[model samples]
Target: MTVILLRHGVSTSNVAHTLAGRSAGIDLTDRGREQAQALVQRLGSLPIEHIVCSPLLRCQRTVAPLADKLGIDVEPDERLLEVDYGDWTGRPLGELISEPLWKVVQRHASAAVFPGGEGLAQVQFRVVSALREHDAALARKHGGEVLWVACTHGDIIKSVIADAYGMHLDLFQRIVVEPASISVVRYTPTAPFVWRVNDTGSDLSTLAPPRDPAARSGPVPGGETGNTVSTDNEGVEHPDSHTE
Candidate 1:
């Protein structure tokens, strides 16, 4: 089966660089919508047989445009949500960077979670578990040739994909999932392999010469407009990220 992982669009929390993990009710920014729409224009043409998302409003809104475009319903899964931030939810990035624990988390970034937040290992276990369940379903349904999409947070999606390739937590920083980015993976129950991880809006290459550099600098015609299409939220995972 082939799985595509996507981060939600920009949210209010993202504006301040705050940790919006598991914080409820946040919505996508206008730019975020444009990004999602761009993704829709890019992938909407694919035979997207399945879609799962985190339940957070940002993720919901992010995927809604695509669902509307594709005429498909998002399958919300709780297990795919962001890891809980504990007391760190809604905290500003500056404050988090100042704390000693945050420093430890940086060094042991993948292992040192917040005081009350879910551990990286645990988060990986559950998220991968959910993924495996889906894989089984897809394998059974399509004989292992199914294409699926799971929209999730930056860290949650990154950790699982990286660990699958023997990458360490400190390496997590290297796999940056810009808001509204897409990561693709192809896996089988027995032998799994990662195809691509965390490709951003800038990575797309489909184009034809319009003979105008100025026009090329802007969003591709009939493509998503690029006006800071990100959102403010946990910058990480969501509870309903399956929105699960």
Candidate 2:
């Protein structure tokens, strides 16, 4: 089974460095829409049989173009929802420290929970369960010819990948998930293998930048991570009130 995790394109929260925190209804920006188009064109060449979308606007928007290309509707699932950030909603990392359980959450994700939110163990339960079930369904449906796309947020995607591969959160925190990027994993009918990580729309094989001396390379340089949609995290909440 082959599973490709994709972070949604740019959104309002990305530009402000604030927590979206399971806030529903955020929409994709113009550039984000374009990024989705790029994903369609790039991955269009691959034999994609199914798409899993979070019940959020950014994810739906991100997968819409790809669904058009595949001639299939996105399969929505509530388990893919982002973490509920509770009191930290709309606040940036700096201000988020003021939240009640921020310290515990930052240290031991498994033990942390927002005021009115979920714990890391709970988040992992749903996300991981969703993934396994999706794998089973896709395997039965497509056999070997399957490319499943999951439109999800930064933290959730990171946590799913990290937990699946047994990576430490420290490394997970450093890994970035840019807008409309493609992170790939493949399990050969038995075990899972993460073949690639956070590849942006700009990294599309067909549209990837030329290997020139000036080509922007190596982790996309810090401070340049912000926009309307993007981030480097795992086990985080979704943004609120998206539209697009």
Candidate 3:
């Protein structure tokens, strides 16, 4: 199965270079809406069976277009919410960069906690757990492989990438998830494979038309540690073939 991660479109605060965090009332700019619509064109061909999104208004708005087009109701998952910037919420990014905590966030995120909110480690744990649990259930429910979209924030997406790479939490900052970008991950029973990261544009048709079950020799259903199916010698393109 594949989990495609999408960062929310640019919000009003994004243009102002401010950290919107959990702030209320921040909606996507007109360009953001355009980007959301463009996303529909980018992924319209894929057989997306499930959609998940963060509770934040920006993420909700970002996924609205695709969900409507696919006739799929987006399930709001709080675990995908933007990092709670706490007192730093609504502050300009330029200003926050001067703060001491900013350095900690960049160099030692696992040890950095929001002044009055959650820690990066905590965010990573819940978000990754939510994704794993949801992925397994969706694969089973759909019978065999599945394709799903997760509309979330940049930091949240980066955290998941870091986890899949088995990198320490502090190193997550090295990964970049641009607004309106798409990243992908495929989990077999053995290990997780990152197919793409922060891809803003590309043809996604390569993912279409599910593979024939008779051709695959790997584990049947899906689980965290399912056996890896090797399709190399047969020249078969894995649905989760695209990678970073």
Candidate 4:
């Protein structure tokens, strides 16, 4: 199964450089609404069977246009919501940077826990588990591979990408998920393939699965020679290059 991770577009908090962190009444900025509309043109061609999104309004608005175009009902999934920043909710990013925990969040996210809020490790676990569960359910429902979208927040998308690369949670900061950007992961029996990350504009039609059923499974003979991003096994499991 393939899951496309889409970050919500720029929000009012984003314009103010604040950590929205599950706060209420946060809406998309004008630019963000435009980006949401653009998603129809960007992803309309893909065979997306389902649309699951964070319950937050920002995420709901982000996927609205595409869902309308596709005529699909958007299902709200709490697990896809943004990180619960607890006391840090509504705090400006600049102010949060001055806190002592900022360093830990950047360098050792696995050990970082927000005061009165959930931990980064906890965020990763829930989001990954939700994705895998959804993937399994979709596969069973379709009786084969399927494509779907998960509209969510930045940190959640980054953590999911980190897991797809088999990287430690501490290294998730190295991955960047821009507002309204799209990342993709294909889960197989052997491993999860990180096909695209932080992709704002590109020919996504290549993601369409081949018509041949037999061509879908197994690895390529020459290790998938083409314009693709993947991990290296050169004494490390992390991605060798950054995905923008």
In TM-score terms, candidate 4 sits at 0.90
lDDT order of candidates, top first: 4, 3, 1, 2
Clashing pairs in 3: 189-225, 189-226, 195-242, 195-243, 195-244
Model 3 TM-score relative to the real fold: 0.86
| Candidate 3: regions farther than 4 A off | 209-244
Q: Judge candidate 4 at residue 61 and give its lDDT.
A: 99
- Model 3 C-alpha lDDT versus the unseen true structure: 0.79
Tens-digit lDDT track for model 2 on 138-186?
7787643356788888778877777657776534554555667678665
Q: For residue 183, what is the lDDT in candidate 3?
A: 87
**Clashes (N, CA, C under 3 Å) per candidate:** 32, 19, 5, 0
Task: Compare the candidates by lDDT and give the number of the best one.
Answer: 4
| Candidate 4 global CA lDDT score | 0.84
User: What range of 10 consecutive residues in model 3 has the weakest lDDT sum?
Assistant: 235-244
lDDT scores in order: 0.70, 0.67, 0.79, 0.84
Instruction: Judge candidate 1 against the unseen true structure and give its global Cα lDDT, from 0 to 1.
Output: 0.70
Pairs of residues clashing in candidate 4: none
- TM-score of each model, paired residue for residue: 0.79, 0.77, 0.86, 0.90
What ranges in model 4 sit over 4 Å off? Answer: 213-215, 218-221, 225-244
Q: Give a tens-digit lDDT track for model 1, residues 1-244.
A: 6677888887777775778889888778787788788787767767678889988888888888888888888999998888787888888777777788766655676676667877776777789889889878977887536677898887778777776677776666566676787776656444455545555543322222123434334444675433223322334332221121
